[model samples]
Target: MTRFYWRKYRSLGVVTTLAILYLIVRAKNYEHKAFVFLANVHPSEPWEFVADFSNMKYLNPTIIDFNLLDESGDYVHWKYSLEYSEKLSHWPHSYNTAVAHFNIKASPKKDSYFIHSTHKTCLLFGLYCLNSVSEFKFSHGNSSKGASCEEHIQYQCPTVLSSFCRREVVYQRKAIMNNLFKKFDGRKF
Candidate 1:
């Protein structure tokens, strides 16, 4: 019985190793672009909220929000929080807080989407997150240290700045959408 079990276990390990190789090959473009937005998303959404792209080195961005337990074992829904690094007082450091802080528990009234919403208009800014199934928001442009959330840009030409947290507004479509739904359409689209 022991010999039989070992044979099966060895085969399983080999299969898992092959799968990891495939993933690494597919991640070639990950470093090319960085994003930040909602920290998590609803199970219904395709891509869970991705707050940063730096974390990509250790994380595999997923659109599927599932029940997971962190080191504490508490049921915390963790979405793609753009895994990146920064200088802490001039020291290099990785951060996913900007991505983790974004919580979109409202909007579309559903837990879905992976990209960020620049505004209430559902603009494709960067990433999106949903905790319950209500609120939702997006982040765009690059981010830098000492940069304010609304003042930093999450993306720069599809490349997320890896300097500091510079949460800048990349999309104003939300304002336009609000006005359109509010019987106001004088603003540009």
Candidate 2:
């Protein structure tokens, strides 16, 4: 009887271990959002502004440090540190800083520029990983000195934290758009 009981418990232990491993290694789906706005400046202006890594701090105040790791013909690898605060339902706000790495490829056309960037970061002691892709296209607008910009962002994170990530993505994108408009148009968005 002891042998039989030992074998049954061993099987149960193996099953439990497999289930936990599956939960830890499961793949997450990406969420996407696209934003379009007009800037009262030439297409090349905003394109240049975005392509330069040093100018990021001006666009996003949360970014405290920016560094270039590598640069090839049309591709650049960089990293930046950003500080943010989060508030839970009834808990006090928590402040944290995160460093993210980016790889960007830029292409210039006759009257437009396209940029593709990949971002990666690990959060919560590396238990949760966040990956995102951002595409920016700047083209000539209806007016001579106007430019139309489209930003598309896709992000992947654990399901439990997806809502929070979505909210942050929308808020940050809108804030960037507003800042861009103010910089180029000299008016509020």
lDDT of each model, Cα atoms only? 0.27, 0.60
lDDT over C-alpha atoms for residue 60 of model 1: 33
Question: What 10-residue stretch in candidate 2 is worst by lDDT?
Answer: 83-92
The TM-score that candidate 1 achieves is 0.18
lDDT of 1 by residue, 1-189 (tens): 999999999999999999876553331111122222222222322123123223222233211122222222111333322222211222223211222333223225332323332211111232322111112232221322111111122332222322321222212223322322233112121
- The sequence of per-residue lDDT tens digits that candidate 2 reaches over residues 102-144 is 4343443447666677666555555555667788777765555
TM-score of each: 0.18, 0.67
Poorly placed runs, candidate 1 (over 4 Å): 1-45, 49-100, 106-108, 111-153, 156-189
